[model samples]
Target: MSRYAEYRALAQSLGVDAVALVPGPNFVRLMKQDFHSHERPLLLVIPAAGPVAAIVPNLELSSFAKLGFEGEVFDWMDQSGYAGAFAALARHIPLGSLAVEGQVMRVFVHHALATAFPGLKIVDAEREISGLRLRKTAEEVAALEGAIRISELALAEVLDDVRIGMTETQIEGHLIQAMFRHGASELAFGPIVAAGENSALPHAHARDVPVQPGDALLFDWGARHGGFCADITRTVFVGHASDEAQAVYETVLQANLKGHEVTRAGITAHDVDDAVTGVLEASVFADRIRTKTGHGLGREVHEAPYIMRGNRQLLEPGMVFTNEPGLYCIGGFGVRIEDDMLVTQDGCRSLTTFPKGLRILG
Candidate 1:
């Protein structure tokens, strides 16, 4: 909720003295083009060596004021010519060194800001800001908890509807309906209803096959509510899973559980990954591992501190993410076991609790 504070901390890290923000989301949030307000445009002014001030467009004056700002305000008017907006904004402070979110900010905005401070030092500020938001706050974790509840309920209903001869598309419809019924405003991502061979794709979102008896069904889905998201994946086998299918399923489940055992406060994401990697190597399905051990899931479905090779971010309390270990065999059946987790002060707690043991669906 406080993207400003995160940027302020970044400004401090970059040796800046103060910061400023210009409203940049007039086209999206105000225009109804996008539903997300967090992605709306905003300008951050950081004074690395001294103090900071704020300058905003006339149209954004009230919006900025609503932010309950405590610093100086330089309102820019644009009723006249092309330079009015830029000039008015530029009139706020004498430029020295400024950092902007180059990765997330639009190119046009970057160009305009650069033009206004041609003589001042302009630097890419993405890493600085992203580092500040790597940790989750209490309020943020609460929102994610709600999202997880809605999502798990949806999953339970989806599992209940599983029957032989149903197409993947039909399963997706039931999932969407369950999500809405459980309180999701919309899907956090497309509900993956892959059956048998489709499950081998890992990220297959298209649903186009009938679910037959004794086939692997992977449902990778999430739900969005109150501006938060939940991510979870679960795989099941229809009645009479082949020996290969059962073996892969059990191996994936063991890898998932092994990885979960190592997730705790103070543990690095790489540590958790290595724990699972060890179990995967020990198991016969080691060669079948096809994806990362897990990933951080909050705010955006995929965010900071991802569980991948060489990521050294320590698992901190209040952090929420996913532990989804998957195994894929080309042309053969694959399996994946996933669940949403919240990092507690001591260890991690699962948010989604639908039965994960191998289920033979018919």
Candidate 2:
């Protein structure tokens, strides 16, 4: 069934008059089009039974028309204000209770929608909609794999230019340039280039501090390909590795591997988090943990099926997420190993192949 058809069925099951989408990933998935956030509100409503309708800005009519929209379109110009468009859409669709992206739709848009249909109920169906994009198709997995390969290659190229006197920000520049040179369409997120004390800050902003000989330089970054993303982290020594650093690295590496080992169909997300965190809690570096083990990764850097404590979402085939576990010691050093994984029929397969073992780089 088409995505719209599937959504219509879901809305019918929930007894909602329609399922609405705003400008974001859900819009991209259903419409195969990109819509930017503007002062004028744009909404696409797929009723339980009828054609899909939209409330779009007059300037965007051409863009929306390209979708070959099969229903009525209520468009208003900037000078006219959007209230008329909302009212026209309301008159056409006529809602009882409409389902919307509770997490995404803006309050102003909601108010406008409520004003158009008095006594209208707006139900949150974020889960039902987001769930549609949770499991990736074969094409998506391949695109993610391509993105990971480009990210790894870019890191390798930048590593050749890294030296002791270079600041973290300088290294970030080198990495970004390399990512583009290596054919990455876009970056999943800003590359994290941290060293020494800065590395202890899990989500550290790259600073001007010169990398030292004994510093643990943590590099966390990803690349985008075909709209899919890959997130990977690797912590390497600048010149020499200390015993303490090695121990911490090994412990975190074990936790990362444990996270992968415990991931498979039928396993609860909490179980995987518990098993991974268990590996660290059993060690003396337990207090070093500063963040959740990992998070879902795909079109957006972070999505559904987050890997954290108390989440009961089950692992399923085609689901992809990160398996990163880190140890951070304030004013000391930090180590993290992150790899994207795809849940398979039995277990999970790592999408990133960057060596996890300690690498001593200049």
Question: Which candidate ranks first by TM-score, i.e. highest?
Answer: 2
For residues 1-362, what per-residue lDDT tens digits would candidate 2 score against the true structure? Answer: 65589879878987999999999878887777778866779999999988889888999988888987778888999998999989988888889999998878999999999999999999999888878888999988998999999999999988888998999999999998888888899898988999998899988899988888999999999988778888999999989999999999999999999988889989988888899999999999999988887888888888888888999999899999998899999999999999999999899999999988889996
Question: What residue runs in model 2 are displaced by over 4 Å at the alpha carbon?
Answer: none
lDDT of 1 by residue, 1-362 (tens): 44345455656677654443333222121222322223232454645433345555556667666665555655555554234444445666666666665555666666666677666566676555444545667776777778888988988887888888888998899988999999998788887888878888888875667888878888888898766678888888877788888888888888888866778899888888888877777888778878888777765677666887698888888777788888888777678888877787788888777788888764
Worst 10 residues of 2 by lDDT: 29-38
- Candidate 2 has which clashing residue pairs, if any? none
Candidate 1, superposed: residue stretches over 4 Å from native: 1-6, 16-65, 69-84, 119-124
| Candidate 1 weakest lDDT stretch, 10 residues | 24-33
TM-score of each: 0.82, 0.95
lDDT to native, each model: 0.70, 0.90
* Cα RMSD (angstroms) for every candidate in the order listed: 4.5, 1.5
